[model samples]
Target: MQLVEDDKYGWSAKPSSCEKGHAPKEISVDFDEVYKSIILPAINLINGTNLGIKIDCTRGEDLLDGGNIVSQFLQKICQAEITITDVTGFNSNVIFEYGIRLSVRDSLNILLCHEGVKLPLDFAEQRFKTYHMGLGGGNDAKDYIVETIRHALPLLLAEKSVESVENLFRRTVENATGRTQERRLMEVFEPAPDLLVRLLNALNTICSEANAPGDKKVFRLDPKLRDETWKLLEEIGKTMENSSNLSRAIELYELLTKLEGFREKRRDVFYNLNKLCSANPDFKEKAQFFLERGIELED
Candidate 1:
C-alpha cells in the first residue's frame, strides 16, 4: 500500500513550527501549495490497487476545505470501485498518514498486476474471507493473513492450473476448514462472554434444524462430533445461568468448539470454568475441581 499526502494550503511548507507564535498567513500559503501539487497525483493512481483509497481532509484547516475538490478528482480516477474513507482532525498533515497506507497498497498492487497472473475470482473471494472473518483483531491475524496469501496464492494458482473447479474447491476446503477450526479454538479459550450464549444458541438451532442435514453437513456430526459436542455442552452446563436454556447453548457451544479444534485453548478451559463457577452458585464444586486440575497442570 502506498500513500501520498498533498497539503494544498501549504500549511506544512512554512517555518511556523520554529516561531512560538501561530501565523495564520504561513498556514494559508502551505495549504495552497499542497492543493496544487498533492491532490491530483493521488487521484490518478487509484485504479491499480484493490484496497482502494482513503482520503483525509483535516489538513486544509481554515482556508479552503479540500474535500470536495479531492473527492471530485478521485471520482474522475475510478468512478465506482474506488473507496473513499475520509477523516477530519486538527492535525497539520493528515495526508501523510494516508499516503503511507497508499504506498504499501500500491506495492502489493504492483506485484499482483506485474505477475500478469489473474487469480480466479474464487481464489480472491477465499483470500478475502480468510482476511475479514478469520484473521486476528490486533496485529497477529492481519500479518498472518497477508503473509499467508503472499505465500499461498502462487502455489494455489499453479497447482490448480488446467484443473476443474471441483479440484480447486477440494484443495481450498481443507484450508478453509483449518481456518474455521483455528477460530473455533480461539472462541473456546476466549469466549465472547457477552455474545457466547446467544451465538451458541444460534449454532444449536442450526445444527438440529431439519435443514441441518445434507447440505448443512458442514459440521459433520459423527462419533468425533458427538464427543466434542458433549464436551462443549458440559463446559456450557458448568457456567450456564438457571434461566438459560441448558440444551441449546450447551449443545451449540460444544459442537462449535469441538468442530473448530481449540488445541491451544485447552488450558483455558479451567480458567473460564472458574469464572463461570463464580458467576453461578450451583457450579462452585465443579468449578473448584477444574480449577484445581488447571493449577496442577500449571505446576
Candidate 2:
C-alpha cells in the first residue's frame, strides 16, 4: 500500500501542506516484518508451552497507531482473535493479564495434592489489598488508572493466589541469601505438580496454535515469565526425571533461537546447548549437530 496508490478501501487523502513543499512522512507498512520480528517469535515460545494471553493495548497515536497497525495485521492478515480494546486514556504499555481464575484453580489443586509451593500469603494479601483499594498492582497498572472494581477484583484475586504460592518458596529460601537474588528466589519456590501440568497444557495449546497451517505466526511471552518458564522446565527435568520437562526445555530453546534477531545474547544459546545435551543423552546427537552448526556460522 502506498500513499499515492488507492486501495479497494480508498486512497489516503493527500496532505494539504504538501502543496507548500510540506510532505507527510511516509510510513513503512512492513506488518510482515513486525510479525516476523515481534509477534511470530513470541508465538513460537507459546508453541513450546501451554499459555494463553489477553494482551490489552492502550490507545494513543503513538501506541494505538502502531498497535492498530499490528492489530490489523494480526486480526485481518493473521486472523486470530487477539482481543484489542480502546480503554480511555490507556497508554501503550502492555499488560500480561494472567487469568486469576486459572491461578485460583492451580492453587486449589496444589492444596489438594498437599504439594508444597511457596505461595506467600502475606505478599498475596498485600497485592490483593492494593488492587482492592483500586491501587496499581499489575505491571501495567503503574501507568493507567484502576477504572472499575470489577476489573480490579479479579486482578487482586490472581495476584494474591500467585503470591500465596510464592510465600511457600520464601520459607524454603529463608536460609540461603546471596548475590543471585533472582536465581535464588526462583530456586526456592519450585512449581507444584499441578502448576507444572497446567503450564505444560498451556504450552501445548500455544504450540498447536503456532504450528497450525495457513499462518504460522509467533506469540510473544513476557520476558521475565519466559525466563522463569525455561528455568522451571530445566529444574523439573533435572529433579523430577519427567520426559515432558526435557521436551519443554528443547522447545523453549528452539523458540529462543528463532528470536535471535530480537536479542543480543548469543552465548546463552551455546550455554543451553551444552547443558541440554549434558542433561539428556537422548538429545546429545541433535544438540551436538546444532552446536557444530553454530560454530560454522560464527566462523
Candidate 3:
C-alpha cells in the first residue's frame, strides 16, 4: 500500500492488491509525509504482531467510490472502530470530522498533532498525542503513536467506555445543577436540626448497607448518591466547625471516618477532629486517638 497525495484531499492510501478484504482503520491527516513516515510505520508495527486484530489504514478519501464524499466520510467516521485524526495544521475538515466522532463515540478516538501546536479551546482539555516532525523525529513520532494505541487497546477490548468530550461537558453541567439543588435542600432543612441529622444518618446507613455483605438485590446505593452524601457531610462538618459548634462538627467528622467514600480526606478529618477534641479536657483520650491516626496516615 502507498500513500498518494490528492489535490482535493491532502493524502490518502492507494489500496494495493494485498490490502483488500480486511477491516479499514481510518486515519485523518493533513500532510502526505505524515502518512508515509509516521502513521504508516506505526501501523506496520501494530499489524505485524499477533495482537488479535489487523489494521488496514485508510483515509476518508480512500473510501470514495463514485458517491457523495461528505456522506461516505461521515459514515466512515461514525462506524470505524478507531478514528485517528492528525490535527497538526488544525485543518477545518479534519476538525469537523473529529467533532462528529467525539459526539457519537465514547472511546477509541485519538488526536495526533505536531509538537507545540495549540488546539482550539473546545478541544484543549481532550487528551491528544503530540510529536515533532523535524529531522530524526519520525521514529519518535511513530513510537509515540504505537504507545498511544497500545494503551487504548485494553479499554477497547474490556468494553469499558471512556468519557467522551461531549459527555464530559454534559456531566459538568449536571453536577453544577445538582450541587445547587442540594444547597437549596440543605437550606430548607437547616432550621430543623433534628430532621437534618436524621437525613444525614439515613444517607450514612444507605452507604453502609450498600457495601455490607448480603444479597445484592436487598441493598444497593447509586455511586452518585454515595459521593453526594459524602460531599454533603464534609461541607456540613466544616460549616459546623467554622461556627464553633465543635460537638456537632466532631460527630460529623467521626461519621466520615466510618464511611468508605473519600478515603483521601480522612487524614484531614482526623486533623480537624484532633484539633476539636484537644480543646476540651474531657476529650483528651479521643484527641490522642485522632492524633495517632493522623500521624499513621502520613506514612
Model 3, runs deviating above 4 Å: 1-30, 158-299
TM match of model 3 to true structure: 0.42
lDDT of 3 at 298: 93
Give one digit per residue, the lDDT tens place, for model 3 in 129-171. 6665567666876787678777776655555222232222223
Query: What are the lDDT figures for the candidates, one per model?
Result: 0.34, 0.33, 0.56
Which of 2 and 3 is ahead in lDDT?
Answer: 3
Clashing residue pair totals per candidate (backbone < 3 A): 29, 26, 0
lDDT of 1 by residue, 171-244 (tens): 23235336433233333433332133234434444445535436544443344444554455566556656623
If both were scored by TM-score, which would come out higher, candidate 2 or candidate 3?
3
